[model samples]
Target chain A: MDAVAAEWWKLRSVRSTYWTLSAAAAVFVFVLLLAFQMAHIWDGLSVERRADFTLRPLQELGGWAAALCLAVLGVLSVTSEYRSGMIRTTLTVVPRRGRVLAAKAAVVGTVALVAGEAVSIGSFLGTRLVVGDRPFPDQGASIAHDLPDFAIVGASVAVFALLGMSLGVLLRSTAGALVSVVFLWHVLPLLVFQLPEPWNERVGSVMPGALPGQIAGRSADSSIYGDLLPPGAAAAVMLAYALVPLMLAGFALSRRDA
Target chain B: MCGGPSRTTVDRMIEVRELTKRYGATTAVDRLSFTVRPGTVTGFLGPNGAGKTTSMRILLGLDAATSGEALVNGGGYAALRRPMREVGALLDAGAVHGGRRAFDHLGWLARSNGIGARRVAEVLEQVGLAGVARKRVGGFSLGMRQRLGIAAALLGDPGVLMFDEPVNGLDPDGVRWIRELMRSLAADGRTVLVSSHLMTEMELTADRLIIIGRGRLIADTSVRELADRFRRGVLVRTPRPAALTAVLAAAGGSVESMPGGALTVTGMDVAVIGDRAAARGIPLYEVTPHSASLEEAYMELTAGSTEFGAVAS
Candidate 1:
């Protein structure tokens, strides 16, 4: 419990946390502006032209900006200690290395979950207010509805943050961890589609990088996702990505020298 | 609470027995064994790459030992219910994030041991960092960083303390301050172990010394004893050195003529040599016992054990 408090204090004491969160808010506002503009011009558009308006405000704002910033947040929690040599001090104080990792994961995971939910709910409500009481086509989903999907978006952000922390422990270098996270999330999604037949579809459904879209109800064409899992099952798969690596990291940390 | 002082008494000692650490084929610390008892400052002396850091790491449970035990207060470091209350260490002062304030840097460490935040403020003042308590550590000079590290170490007010070359980048005043701090900590009955590669630094601060070379123990004795062991012949300066040399050699003392009309007389004491020279009617300018400095003694003791001394071709 003392270790948890220490991790909490450590996470908030640095400027990078505030900077990254600010950047996340800035990106969320950009997405909000685009959603508000689309709601204002809904009357002038035709049925075929309106099909292109597929922005799920909750996912678009929280998924892209929050995932990227929270990844940095989680990765820096461990990597910064390694880079500064504070890991020696930390391990000396809390010699059970697994406890150290657990505290960090809890803190970063909580912060990511809370911040993600805030921005995603904010984006959803802002769009709801803009498109208020309008008799529109089927494209505009009511903000008062779809609460479960919004919760999934927030949970996905937390999972991504945990994944980043696990990578930080495995790699133990800031540049290497961040690069691996970016490659796994951004680059792997684009390349997975090139595989042939059932293999692509089978791999795509479980890909953690693409699960954010699934959580947001923006599942890509059947060719990209193959056969999409239900939202709850998709969340569990996304969670496995964070949990499996976290277990490996725990085993390695206790055995390896700092 | 800031000025309150309590000298707690506890069995604060470090014991390492047959401790060996090997990376693949090369052994970093080879069968090393030693004890650091309370109420004295034990200087852990070794050259660079001599496994001092590795041994300390293993002792603190930062690294696992290949064999043997390193126990503090009768148990492993990780097993202590309140480790910060039992041991405090300043291994690397620079291992702090520069973006953090001095207060927060010590605050987290204090929190880890269930120490109160008031103690954090007390330690900040104790290390003379109260002025820069709100400043970022990144902008601090190396001296300030060392002080902050020391503050963190003292946060829990542990019974046992260890510092690895705590004087590395300190100025002259800072050096004096640390020497005093080590002595005071020991005076309070705490087991203080400080490691340094420079024998001169250890000579001024340590009450007992444990010298190692090439990951092996060379000597575990006091500073005074080491200097005495390395003390050689008596240096005698005289007019007509040939007469003194003959008298000294005739008196069963081996004498070697030096360049400045002096003789290095061995196998005899200064009193006996002075009397022999006086009996011979030889005029003596000076007679002085040649005792080795800590630096010279350290060199002579570890000469064979130095891992990377420059080879003169």
Candidate 2:
């Protein structure tokens, strides 16, 4: 309990925590606002069609925006500590490596989850104001969608931040951790999607992105990916990617001399 | 020897037994043992890379010991239920969040082990950091940061305090302040362990000294004893050197004849030598007492075992 309190105090005391979360919130709302404007866009389309347009698509965009929020939160939670060299001090105080890591993941994960839910619900309600009495997207077709569950968002952000923690500990360089996180969490997932055949598609299908799609649901015109496994499985894989390194780093910290 | 690390009582603090640390094939601290008693300033003296820092880190549980043990209150540092209140240490002055304010940094540390925010302010004042309590530590100079580190260590008002290279980059005034601070802390009946390569500073500040070289213990004794063991004989220069030598040698004093017609007298009282020269009709040009310092004595002691070799004199 004391360790958790200490970790929370440390988390709240830093400007970087608030700054990164605010930036994420601003980006999220801004992107959703843009999504709204796009839904109601009247520049090119016919006047009749423009008036007939629905705001349901903005809801899908909201999930993407939330993912971006997690990325920022995840990076800041771990990378900021590495940059300032506070990790050593933190480890010195706590001494329990696994507990420290768990406390950090819990705090950052909770914050990210709350923020993600706000983006989901805020964009869902806010976008509804611009488009009224519209038919929603298909329920079954958007196989991997996440429906703004605080649990899902919390899990996703927790995993991402955990991976960042491992990278910070292993590399001991903020720049290197940041680059590797950006590459491994975001770019690698994208590259996996590009691989030829069913294997590439299979791997990309279960990546971190797999969860958000389930909540957003598919638009009426989209093809059904109903064959895909549930978001829970993909979420598990994403978590595994984060947990393995975290475990390795914790063991190494205990065994090695600082 | 127990299932977990132990915590020693404040009155009977640390016992380090054969503590060793190595990085791969290169040993940083080798089979070193020393006890730091309560209510005394024990100086940890060694040149750079002689394992002073490594030994401190091992004691703090920041580094795993290669072999042996360092017990605080008769237990390992990490095993203590409340380490901060038992043993407070400052290994690095700059181990703080750059973006966070100083008080906030201390606040979190205070919150740990059930300490309060009010104690943080008190500690800040104790270290002369009250004026900059709200300032971001990133903007603080090295000296200010050192003060802040001291504040962190003093926050819990622990029994045993360990400072590694406390006066490294401090200016002369800062150094003096630290010496006085250390003395004051020890005066309050706290165990203060200070490490430094500056032997002269340690000479005046420390009550007892533990000297290390090549990651091993060299000498652990009182400052007075160290200077006494390595004290050179009384130096005397005289025009009638033969007369002084004959007179001093007649009194059972070993005499070394130096150039410039000077005579060095050993194993005899200096005042007696002066009186003997006067009585023997010897006209003495000069007779001076040569007081040996801890730095000079340390140089003589560790001349052979300095692992990385001494810096050019």
Candidate 3:
């Protein structure tokens, strides 16, 4: 518990944490602007053209952008220690390497989860306000009905944050961890999307980015994701994304010399 | 000296038994064993790559030993809950995040061991960094960083403290400050282990010396004992050198003639030599016992064990 408090203090004392969260909040602003543009375009369009317009992508954009920002936050939480050679001091004070990593994971994970929910839910409401009562194709569901999916979207940000921290622990280099995170977060999904036929959908269903929507029982037909798994299996996969890497990282941290 | 309550009910000792660490084929620490007890400063001296840092790392539980135990207070460091409360260490002064303020750097460390925020301010003030408490550490000089590291070590008021090259980048005043601080910590009944390659620095700061070369213990003795082991006899200067030399030789003392009417007398005490000169009615100019410097003794002890030696031109 003391270790957790120390890790929390470490996370908040740095300027990078505020900078990354600000970047995540910037996504909320961008989503609102895009909503205004969408509303303007909707006003000028005929009813036939307006039937095709949807705000679902813009609503999901805030969470997606936040995932990247919080992931960087998670990466910096561990990698910054490694970069400054402060890991030795940390290990010296705590002595238990596993507990140190667990403490950091707990702190970074909570921050990411909170930031994720705020941005995702804020984007949904902000876009709704800007495009009030427009009745887009995907806006048919009531706000209460759509809230759970954004919550799941927010949860996915925590998963990405944990994955980023795991990569930081394993790689121990900011550039290397950030690059690996980007590859897993963005590049791997795009590459899997290009695969042929059944394999593309089969592999895409398990990708980190796709599991959130799948777990929320949303259709992935228009997106670059696959909708093969049921919500239960998708939730299990999302949990795996957050846990498996952390376990591997913990094992590595315990066995390797600091 | 910020010696809070005495937490010395424990053994208050650092022990290494047959401790060996190997990096692939290279053995960083080879069957090394030593013990540092409280109430004295023990200098851990060695050349570069002689495993001083590696051994310290093992003792601190930052590195795993291949086969041996480095125990503090009769247990492994990793097993200690709230280790900082029992053991404090400053391995590398520069191993701090530049983004953190001086206060926050110590703040998080103090928090790790359940120490209070007030202790952080106290330590910063103790290390003379109170003015820079709110300043970022990135802009600190190397001397300030050393002070910050010391403040962190002293945060928990641990009974056992270890410092690796603590005065590396300090100016003359900073160097003297560290020397005095180390002595005071030891005087406060703390087990202080300070590592350095410079024999002069250790000679001034340490009471006991554990000299290692190539990861092997070469000499483990007190500073006075080492100086005595390398004693160079006594130098006797007199106006009648021939008369004094004969009298010393006759009195079972070997005398070697030196430049300009001086005699190097061995196998005889300064008191005996002075008495012999008086008995012979020979006036003596000077009679002084001489011992080799600790620097020379360290060089001779670690002569061939240096891992990186340049050939003489």
Which one wins by DockQ: 2 or 3? Answer: 3
Tell me the TM-score of each prediction against the true structure.
Answer: 0.92, 0.89, 0.97
The sequence of per-residue lDDT tens digits that candidate 1 reaches over residues B194-262 is: 999899999999999998887788889998888878778899988788888888888899898888767
Off by over 4 Å in 1: A55-59, A135-144, A209-227, B1-10, B240-254, B271-283, B309-313
Superposed on all Cα atoms, model 2 deviates from the true structure by an RMSD in Å of 4.4
Please rank every candidate by TM-score, starting with the best: 3, 1, 2
**Global CA lDDT of candidate 1, please?**
0.83
Give the winner by TM-score: 1 or 3.
3
User: lDDT values of the candidates?
Assistant: 0.83, 0.73, 0.92
What digit string (tens of lDDT, one per residue) describes model 3 on residues A1-258? 999999998998899999999999999999999999999999999989888999999999999989999999999999999999999999999988889989999999999999999999999989999999888988999899999999999999999999999999999999999999999888999999999999899999999889889888989999888999999999999999899999999999999999
Rank list by DockQ? 3, 1, 2
Chain B TM-score of predicted candidate 2 relative to the true chain B:
0.92
Off by over 4 Å in 2: A42-57, A134-155, A214-227, A238-242, B1-12, B278-286, B307-313
Question: Across residues A190-256, which tens digit of lDDT does each residue of candidate 1 receive?
Answer: 6777778767877787777567556555556733454377666776778788899899889888888
**Candidate 2: tens digits of C-alpha lDDT, residues B73-159:** 788877776677877888888777887889988998887767888999898988888999889899999999999988888877888
True contacts kept of each: 0.82, 0.59, 0.85
lDDT of 2 by residue, A36-126 (tens): 5664553456766756554445554554455555655566666676676566667666767677777776776667667666665566555
